[model samples]
Target chain A: MDRNGLEKQCLEVRRLIVKSVYEAGSGHPGGSLSGVELLTTLFENFLKFDPKNPKSDSRDYFILSKGHCAPLLYSIMAFKGYFPVEELKTLRKLGSRLQGHPDALKLPGIEVSTGSLGQGFGVAAGIALSLKIDKKVNKVYALLGDGELQEGTVWETAMAASHFKLDNFCAVIDSNKFQIDGSVETVMGVEPIKQKFESFGWECVQINGHDLKQVDEAYQAFLSHKSGKPFLIVADTLKGKGVSFMENTEKFHGKAPSPEEFEKAMIELGEKAL
Target chain B: MKKYLALREIYGQKLVELGKNDENIFVMDADLSGSTRTVLFKNQFPDRHFNMGIAECNMLLFAAGAAISGKTVFASSFAMFETGRAWEIIRNTIAHDNLNVKIVSTHAGISVGEDGYSHQANEDIALMRAIPNMQVLCPADALETGAMIEYAAETKGPMYIRLSRETFPVLFQEESYSFTPNQAKVLKDGKDVTLIACGRMVDFALEASHKLEDEKISVRVLNASSIKPMDSEAIIESARKTKLIITCEEHSIIGGLGSAVIELLSDSYPVKVIRMGLKDVFGQSGKPQELFKFYELSTEDIIKTVKENLQ
Candidate 1:
């Protein structure tokens, strides 16, 4: 798909994100919306996953390390035909496979179950190591929240990934800046994120997370990396990028949009208010 | 004089043998390869073994990932760190997903000795048993450890094989010994009283039974190695047969084999039960034998408990 087509998909996914969270009555819409373009562009172009055979051994693995953004992941996964797009309505509902957090056992295409933050990245690094040992070229990708970097295990994984020279592993930090408590800067700063990853021996690049072209180029660079080190893409994104009222606010970090706010969010995302 | 062997050393040798046959067998250690003896496997299959540094959480999560990729992974660390520090990771990631990761940890119980309370893992069995889809095993001797490791590799899903830092007297013969999960081994049968024990304490229980025999008291000994899917049938049978039971371990009295036997017998068949272990206390720096005597987990302690309970 061209950049223009990918942008349209992003809009559609953003709409789905709002709708899913709206229907579920609660979710992290801000972080979910922030990761739209990064995930949209990756799924459409970079990620080598098959919708038909979701468990194919040859396929690339994608782990939502920041599992609170399940709304976005579920939307994109649904859009990419892993499951029925209409089933997005079942988000966090009883007996629904769309759990509150990403459960790999309960859902196809989820490589690792990740709700207790920092665990998915560790699992991702391990998968990368496994693939490396088996001499397979399967790439492992993990998307982490900026606030999630506060976990010690993330750094532990980062060090191991680089120490093991896992060039096949790529990690992206969805740096939307707002956590539930407030701004990430105030709630234990993870700034100098690029430098920190670099110090940990990761080949890193910073980009505007919501920019499809930039996200595409960053992934391309990771693909072409010859540093013999793991890759880290520090994406500078906006909390609730597509929506107007919810953008840059911590209120929507976890709270669901009210009926009126949901209508406004849909209108802003170029979708009919349900 | 009985010959004693270290369970961790047997574990390392058995893992190397298993790795030689199965190409997909992988070993991981959290920087304690020397202490845990995974270094032996690392020496042979350097490509398949991973030294995951001192991060137990990362090591377990990594083991889960490796297992997810269809590799049988044996991850090792001290029991305290493996089960305590990385407990939630084991519960949520490994056990919850039912991954094929065998966590064979050493330095379990007060028998860790010299390392003090910080290194001892008196609650590992309890922690592992509480998790769904997790099978907990505490081997009685070198042969059982080797057999349990073999079983863990062949079996699917998460398993925690607890090992002690101290060497134990070998009880089972190599040709005759067979490991079956949830089945207790009857080392001796008597009508007066029953002694159910796990790990190194099994040897002590046998000695206690022999001492009681000299005193004209009949005693039965059951090695309750499989802790999670506990030998409920053997426990109930003993409760019905002997009417008095004493459970012993080198772990805390709160939740190891003692608690497991009591939980099973209390529900299925009620009997007079006395638990002999570290009664909710931390271990200090001492030799394994000294720690056992100081903590009152010695064979003499078992004999005294049986005599007191019988009277």
Candidate 2:
């Protein structure tokens, strides 16, 4: 699809993020709304998965290391025909298939269970390593939170991926500035992120996360990478991109909007309020 | 009549044989392949072996990734790193998903001599047993170690098998012995008192029973190897029959074999139970035998504890 069509899909995903988190009455809207375009670009263009046969051995795998952004993944996967789009309403409810965290056992189209910080990144690297052992050319991709990088396991697995030269593996740091308490820098600085991955023997790319054209081109370059090193894309993103009231603030990092605030967010996202 | 063998050596040899028969068997080590004896499998099947460097947490999750994708993966390291350091990763990825990964950890307990308390893993049994759907196994001798390895491969879901670094006297004959999961093997039987032990401490229990026999005190020695889904019926029956019970192991008495036995009998049939092993103390740097003696886990310690409790 072209840039105009992909941008439309991103708008729909952002609208769904506001609706789902508002209905559930608790979630991280900041990260979920911020990851809309990256999730749209990956699922719509790059990821190789059959919604019906999610357990297919040959399909490309994706892991959400910042799993609190489950809304972006769930909405995009529903659009890809993984499940009925209407079922997205039951998210975080009792007996709902959409768990608060992505549980691979309960939900289809999810490659692995991921909720704890920095764990899914390691799992994705391992999956990439397994593919190399089997001599399969399939790729593994993961989206990590900038705040989640504070976890030591992330760096450990990062070193393992480079040491093994997992060229088929690719990761994107959703470099949204705000975390739970405040800015990622003030809470615990993880600056020089690009140089860190480069020093670890990874080919690094910087991109405008909200721009669909840049997101598409970065992934295209990742596919053609021949450096025998894993790829890391540090995409600069807004913590709350579509919703004006919540934009660039830590207050909405984990808070659900009120009914009146939900109306304004739906209007800003160009969707009808309930 | 008896041969001494290192459990790690037997595990290394059995793994190589198991790998030859099953192409899907993958071995991962956290740079401890040489000590854990996974190096044997690495030498034979270089393509299937993965040296995950010194990252035990990532190695376990990596093994889970392989296991979920139709592979029987064995991840190895010292007990401290495998169970202590990477416990949450094991619980969430391996145990929660119920993946078919065999976490075989060696150098357990004070048997990891000269490495000090940091290298010893006395709390691994407690740590693993607390997780849901995790099966914990501690084999008594070399024969049982090989059998348990094969059994773990055949069984589905996650398993934690503990092995010691020091050599232990073989208690079972090669052709005659068999392993049944969650079942206790009655090595010897008598009526006066019951002696239950696991891992390297089983040999001491046997020797202690022989020394007690001269005093006309008949002792029953049961090899309680399976720790998690323990032999509750055997323990309850022994409690009813003998009325006196003594539990032994090379690990801490707080949460090892002794704790399992007491937990079982206290509910069903309460009896006078004496636990003989390391108390609430970490092991120090010493030879395996010297450490065992210092911790009061030798044959003399077992005999002394039993005789004191018998009166």
Candidate 3:
């Protein structure tokens, strides 16, 4: 799809994110909105996945290391037709396949079950290492929150990925600044991310996460890099990207929009409010 | 003197044999490859072996990742770090997803000797047994360790195999010994009292039974190797016949074999029971034999417990 087409899909995903969280009555919206374009562009342009055969051996793997952003992941997977878009309403409900966190066993296309932060990144490294050992060309990708970077395990994975020379692995940090407590900088600064990753032997790049074009280019660089080094995309994003009231704020980091707020978000995305 | 063999050494050798037969077998260690003996597997299949540095949490999650991708991953470390430090990772990532990751940890219990309380995993069996979809196995000797590893490889889902740092007396013959999960091995049978033990303590229990034999104090020794699916049938039968039971393990008395047996019998056939292990205390630096005696887990302790319970 072209840039215009991808931009349209991102808007649709944002609307879905608002609607699902509103329907669920309690869910995260800030980080979910921020990750809209990064995931939308990859699923549409790069990721080698067949929604029908989610467990196919030939497919590339994607893990949401920052699993609190399940709203965003569920929206993209639904848009990609992994399951009915309507089923997303059941998210976080009792007996729902779309758990509050991504449950790989219950939901197809979720390559790993992750919620307690920094775990999915390590799992992604393991998958990439397994692929390299088997001489398979399937790529492994994981999306992490800047807050999630505080977890010691993330650094451990970063070190292992580089030491083992997992060229097949790529990790994108959604540097949205805000976490539930407050901005990541104030909470526990994880700045100098690019330098840290580079020193660990990973080829690093900084990108505007919300810009579809830059997200595409970052993924492109990862696919083309011939250096036997893991790739890190330090994506700078807002805590909440789309809605006016929620943008760059910690309030919506985990709070669902009120009925009045939900209608406003839908209207802002150019959709008719329910 | 009884012949003693290192369980970790046998584990390393068995992994190489399993790796040769199955191309998908992968081994991971957390910088303790030399001590855990995964160095043996590493020497054989360098491509399939991963030395995951000193990070235990990342190693377990990595093992879960490889397992989910259709590989049977055998991850090793000292039991304290493997089962204690990375416990939440094992539960949330590996056990919750029911991945094919076999955590074969060495240096379990006070047998870790000189390493002291921080290194000893006296609560590993209890911790592992509580997790859903996790199978906990403790091998009594070299032969049982090999058989349990083989069984874990063939079986699907998450499993934890506990191995001791101290060499144990070889009790099972290689040709005849086979591991069946949840089935207790009847080492010897008597009507007066039942002595149930797992891991290194099984040897002590057997010794106590022989000493009791001379005194006409008939004792039954049951090797309760599979701690989770714990041979409920055998425990109940022993309880019914003997009416007295003594449980032993080289672990905390709280959640290991003794607790498992009592938990079962109390619900089914409640009998006079005495549990022999570290009674809510941490182990200090000492020789394995000295630690066992200090912790009241020696053969003499078992014999005394049995004789007292019978009275």
Q: How many residue pairs clash in each candidate?
A: 0, 0, 0
Considering only chain B, report the TM-score of model 3: 0.98
Proportion of native contacts kept per candidate: 0.72, 0.52, 0.76
Give the C-alpha lDDT of model 3.
0.92
Question: Per-residue lDDT of A1-274 in model 1, one digit per residue for the tens?
Answer: 8988998899999999999999999998999999999898889998998988988989999999999899999999998888999999999999999999999899988987988999999999999999999999999999999999999999989989999999999999999999999999998999999999999999999999988889999999999999999999999999988888888978899989999998888888887887
User: Which candidate, 1 or 2, has the higher TM-score?
Assistant: 1
Task: Give the runs in model 3 whose Cα sits over 4 Å from its true position.
Answer: none
Error of 2 at B102 (Å): 1.3
Q: Which ranges of candidate 1 are over 4 A from the true structure? A: none
Give a tens-digit lDDT track for model 1, residues B1-311. 89999999999999999999999999999999999999999999999999989899999989988988889999999999999999999999999999999999999998888889999888888888889998999999999999999999899989999998888888999888999988898999999999999998999999989988999999999999998898888889999999999999888888778888888887889889999988988889888899999999899998888888888
Q: What is the TM-score of each candidate against the true structure?
A: 0.98, 0.97, 0.98
Residue A174 CA displacement from its true place in model 1, Å: 0.4
Give DockQ for candidates 1 onward, in order: 0.81, 0.67, 0.82
- Per-candidate Cα lDDT values, in order, are 0.92, 0.90, 0.92
Residues B129-212 of candidate 2: C-alpha lDDT, one tens digit per residue: 889999999999999999999999889999999999988898899889999999998888989899999999889999999999
Interface RMSD of each: 0.7, 1.1, 0.8
Docking class of 3: high
What are the root-mean-square deviations of the candidates from the true structure over C-alphas?
1.1, 1.5, 1.1
TM-score of chain A of 1: 0.99
